[model samples]
Target: MSDLNKLGLAEARDALRAGDVTSVELTESCLKAIDEADALNAFVHKTPEIALERAKAADDRIKGGDAPSMCGLPIGVKDLFCTKGVPSQAASKILEGFKPEYESTVSQQLVDAGAVMLGKLNMDEFAMGSSNETSAYGNAVSPWRRGNDDAQLTPGGSSGGSASAVSADLCLAATGTDTGGSIRQPAAFVGITGIKPTYGRCSRWGIVAFASSLDQAGPMTKNVRDAAIMLETMCGHDPKDSTSAELAVPNFEAMLTGDIRGKKIGIPKEYRMDGMPSEIEKLWADGAAMLKDAGAEMVDISLPHTKYALPAYYVIAPAEASSNLARYDGVRYGRRAQLAQGDGITEMYEKTRAEGFGHEVQRRVMIGTYVLSAGFYDAYYNRARKVRNLIKKDFEDVFAKGIDAILTPATPSASFGLGEMTEADPVQMYLNDVFTVTVNLAGLPGISVPAGLDSQGLPLGLQLIGRPWDEGDLLNTAYALENAAGFVAKPGKWW
Candidate 1:
């Protein structure tokens, strides 16, 4: 038999149902893989005891014929999700040793569906940076590398550990949260499938907040079908989160019939940025051609505000982040700093925050604070909100014109070295989110499907943005693209 850790979520589900394997066996396989792949830094926390306990219970439930699709599947939870008694640090020093008393709504729902928790995965500090370099624990390295270069690469940011774990086969599938391009970008970098549901599709109640308006929880998996299965388990209505959509969750896997005939896919002409690599342009064109052959009609469209998405997103996200991150003071949970002899409350606050936050988190908080400051609010924050509305309107106009989903390159390039952009201007790192932020800004569902490999043998992905509250349709289109693209490449195991 093949290694159990190599099984995808869907495959594991089918195997469990057929009595060919038990949840405990799968959980053990993943735990062993997690141990062997420690150098990858995918999992920052390991819950072997809890995982086995849950797996045993899952075996009972499956044998009793009361199993859900996710029953007996082992999954890695992103640190952003508050798992009860497990450290939910959001990859920041300020949140170090903080464990929530209550479970995150999304994670609890997955547990209720019989999914076993492998552990908490690493991520960018407070989900702030575009590359995984901002993580306080250290960067989660991508499994892929340039041909014989042996230099480590990044697995993308915020959800980097989630992407790394899934791509490295450290876990069957993992949870990821997207604010800006966290989920999709990392997934693209690691050659996997990841989807960000419509903004309110997944509840945000227990997940650590990073830009309250843009943060959303979704799954990072090895393939499109596994993404469908995991996403179905992660979404639902929660009264605790005012932003949670009140729609009924559908069987997303059932929607993946791979029939996109007569569906209209829009190609925004504005995405063809100057100096784009020929490989990316060729990959995008090839993806469109595949969809066309699969019977999806290609229509040229434009999102006029595309050029402004990155700037507007930077302003709006930081502004919201400043507001949401204010709760982390010395008085509350998590880490606190030792006071100097003459330090006052003001000094304590300054000292605690300075010591607790990573450099990137501090930068974002400063930028956020500046934008929302009294004199600059109108010039930066408010203006950015207006631009955000225009960006949303652009997408609305495209969808109104009968575009089922918009197709674009998931990232400008494939995975790069971990410290490649860290030395340059921060704006260079921010540009990594250009293709994905608009989806978050517009509160639309978007997915990244691995389409092909770049010249260096690194993976490249294509993105599909769908109408609000229309993830089912978006997923179906991604399924068709996945089938037509037929990208099954995996990184050679060097970790």
Candidate 2:
């Protein structure tokens, strides 16, 4: 049981069912770890009392012979989701004191499946940044490298804390939201596995919007199976989210065929960019080789619109974000700016928004406002939407041409110094999602699997993308890759 900190989801659950441990004990262990490693800032809200209480309920249910899928495990919930009493800040000061009257559909679904909520994890303010520096609560450190007095590294955002906490063993698995590369990138930065299910697979009912069309809630965990378990508990149809697919949730766990003996994997030719470091390129080449060794036939495919993905995402995401965030104009449940004005309510709105949002958020709001304005709407926003449709259509064409999944690099480079990227041009920072944004625009299921490490000892990852509603295949394929590559390693200095 002392080794429980490194145990995967299946192993941990078996430990509980075999009476080798109790839910309360696991929850207490997590609470202790979180307390001891407070410097990571991995969590924004710690509700140990609520967690223990829920663990007790889970134990009672299990003893009564009625345990559900997740049984008594502890899990971290990203702060973007609304909790009835918990302050859901989205890691931004604008929503600092806001609390919701109801729980998010995904959060409620997790609770229903018997998973204990350990706490609310930190994230980029409304899931914006790639390296997590934009978080209002400060950056979450990667659990991978934390000793010898070096500057702390980012735990990738906007799901940074979710990845950090899970890798550090503060929780069994954590919830994450991906808009652009939020889930997969952070998971890579922290040396873990995360999946962004096909858009509309997981409900977005209570999540703060980044780009409504792009934002998706998914799972981050230590291993592929844990991700599967968490996703099984997360996905379903929800009436509140109009974009949610009405189709029935498939049995994901049962669908993992492990044997990819005859599957065809597409290696998109556009992903092999000129700027990628030689080492990462080697990782990709070796990764494809491993898949070939596992009997998957690899072929080159083209997404000619790939270069347009980043610009398209920047336009579409901010445009939608601008409209959605307008609801937070002081009258609703967010920051209210104090302004002296002779004008009516409009002045209050002007002042409140001006002072509440951070620089990045402000920039996005202004851009969103400009793009959606009457004169520019057709030229910018409408054009971007049409391009987004083309990106999705490209994926549809490739998959229909008989490819089970597509492969690519998660980020152009492995985790660099936090300020190295963020301090540069913001467009340069947006380019980190160059390889990832297209999947989001296409509304596809994408994942990042820990492939190997760069010379700097930073972990590198390869992404696997699947057709809509085919997350099980992606996970299974990642599992096979994991088996072949055998590159699993936690943050060497985390302990």
In TM-score terms, which candidate is top? 1
TM-scores of all models? 0.99, 0.97
Error of 1 at 91 (Å): 0.6
**lDDT value, residue 378 of candidate 2:** 99
Q: Model 2: how far is 78 from its true place, Å?
A: 0.5
lDDT of 2 at 240: 96
List the candidate 1 regions with Cα displacement exceeding 4 Å: none
RMSD of each: 0.8, 1.6
The list of candidate 2 runs beyond 4 A from truth reads 146-149, 341-343
lDDT of 1 by residue, 15-102 (tens): 9999999999999999999999988999999999999999999999999999999999999999999999999999999998898899
Identify the candidate with maximal lDDT.
1
Consecutive 10-residue window with the lowest summed lDDT within model 2 = 143-152
Clashes of each: 0, 1
Q: What C-alpha root-mean-square deviation, in Å, does candidate 2 show against the real structure? A: 1.6
Q: Please report how far candidate 1 places residue 96 from its true position, in Å.
A: 1.3
